[model samples]
Target: MKQICAFLVIILLTSCEYFNVKKTSSEAILNEELETFNWNDVDEYPSFSSCDSVSSKQEKKQCFTDILTGHIFEYLQDEIIIVTQDINDTIDLKLQISNTGEITLLESDVDSLTVKEIPNINDLLVRSLDTLPKIFPAIKRGQQVTTEFKLPIIIGVD
Candidate 1:
């Protein structure tokens, strides 16, 4: 019975979870957990000049992603215009953007996801772009801002 109880205690301490380190049955670690963590979940953490200042790399990355996503709508608008333009005046095109920043710009024939119109359209689709999203400035705590980003662009090539 004692052995089973000990095994149960060990199992309770550690569980397989993605992106997280499992804690062991250690007393010191429990004390750390008990201590209140001083974190401002709302105050987005921006880019830190030194890797040392950042609490965790994941926090930094999330800040970057939030900053990037905020401008995702903007970049999508630019991308549609650039790719639809007649580079050599050989293509016909009409492009438009939505308030949410979805895209619809195609040439003669489309072999993938696209829209016939922009207004009143409903659907959220992810596309890859030839150019990556440019990181925009983001507000962080204490008036500090950070810049980092990710954008996927989908180009249909015949």
Candidate 2:
């Protein structure tokens, strides 16, 4: 009887330990999630209403780009630009789309020659953006997020 009782006590202790669950602190869980989270990528790119219907991610991005470029081109075409010298250059336009869907021009990288030929190039670009349709901000982890874009605008005039 004594030996049986000792064996039962040992079994009870072992069974209790087996049922024990390790408690994880909230900080540790949060840290682990942060480590696995990607900061640079967005789940969905910013889009205009016209681009919202697209299903594929790549196609949505392409649609947004096409619409933006088309609007800028149309706006520029409407204006009569006169340059004495033949101008052919590309402007790297840096833009920021806020989480609230507002567009802002961060900067414009214009060559010295291009700047000289088109003094108001920056103004024109800004004005062109002002004419853009209502934009839907980018999405990351199901939350609206601000995003930056570098768009190349080609300027060719004979």
Candidate 3:
């Protein structure tokens, strides 16, 4: 009887652990989820009203780029630009789109030669952005998020 009681006690002690519930705080779970979440990518790209009906992610992105670059190109073409020397260069236009859908020029990577050839190039880019259609901000995890983009604008003039 003594040996049987000791065996039952050991079984009960070990089995108690199975019934115990481990409590996890909400904050801890949220922190863990955030740690594993990818920060570099967005669920949805910023879009124009024209791009709203696009179904695929890649297509949406392409539509956004096409519309944006087309507007800037058209704006630049509308302006009369003349250069002393034959100029051919690519300007990396860094732009930031706020969560509220406002666009701002963060920086323009213009080479000294390009600057010398076209002093108002930066102004032209800024003015072109000012003419952009109303933008819908990028979406990440169902929340509107600010995003930055580097757009390459080619400048060629004879």
Candidate 4:
């Protein structure tokens, strides 16, 4: 009888441990699933109004970039910028679009030569962006979300 009782106790202890392990693992799995659903799931990417006609995701993205590039280039193309250095320069801009369709200048990547040449370049860029029409914000599970974009501006002398 003592031996049988010992065996039952061992079984109970092992079963309890098994349940505990499973509970912890299940909790971890639940957290992981939530993170994936939140971060990795994007229903649709942000796009400019001009891209609305495009159906495919890739095409929409391309159209959005093309339209924005053309617009900014048009804005700065006429301006004559003089720099001390003869090296070719490019400006990298990071823009953020809010859920409410507002655009903000997050950061600008420019070299010393570009800044010295055109100190008000950032302001000009912002003004140019202000003229742009509102963009449709990104969507995730039917809700609009803010998005960021990096744009390259290459400067060439005429």
The C-alpha stretches of model 4 lying farther than 4 A from their native spots are: 1-30, 38-41, 80-87
| lDDT tens per residue, model 1, 1-158 | 99999999887777534448666777777678657544333244333243235576577655554444444345544443423322221222232222223233332222223333331112222342213243223343444333222233333322
Query: What lDDT tens digits, residue by residue, belong to model 4 across residues 52-84?
Result: 889988788788778877888888875676666
CA RMSD for every model?
16.9, 3.3, 1.7, 3.9
Stretches of candidate 3 exceeding 4 Å from the true structure: none
lDDT against the true structure, per candidate, is: 0.39, 0.92, 0.94, 0.81
Clashes of each: 7, 0, 0, 0
Q: TM-score for every candidate vs. truth?
A: 0.22, 0.84, 0.90, 0.75
Lowest-scoring 10 consecutive residues by lDDT in candidate 4?
17-26
Q: How close is candidate 3 to the true structure, as a TM-score?
A: 0.90
Q: Indicate which candidate wins on lDDT.
A: 3
The runs of at least 3 residues in candidate 1 whose Cα sits more than 4 Å from the true structure, single-residue gaps closed, are: 1-25, 28-35, 38-71, 79-125, 128-158
lDDT of 3 by residue, 1-158 (tens): 99999999999999999999999999999999999999889999999999988999999999999999899999999999988999888889899999999999999999898899889999999999999999999999999999999998888888
Number of the predicted model whose TM-score against the real structure is largest: 3
Q: What value of lDDT does candidate 1 attain over all alpha carbons?
A: 0.39
Candidate 2 accuracy as TM-score: 0.84
Candidate that beats the other on TM-score, 3 or 4, i.e. the better one:
3
Ranking by TM-score: 3, 2, 4, 1
lDDT at residue 1 of model 2 (Cα atoms): 100
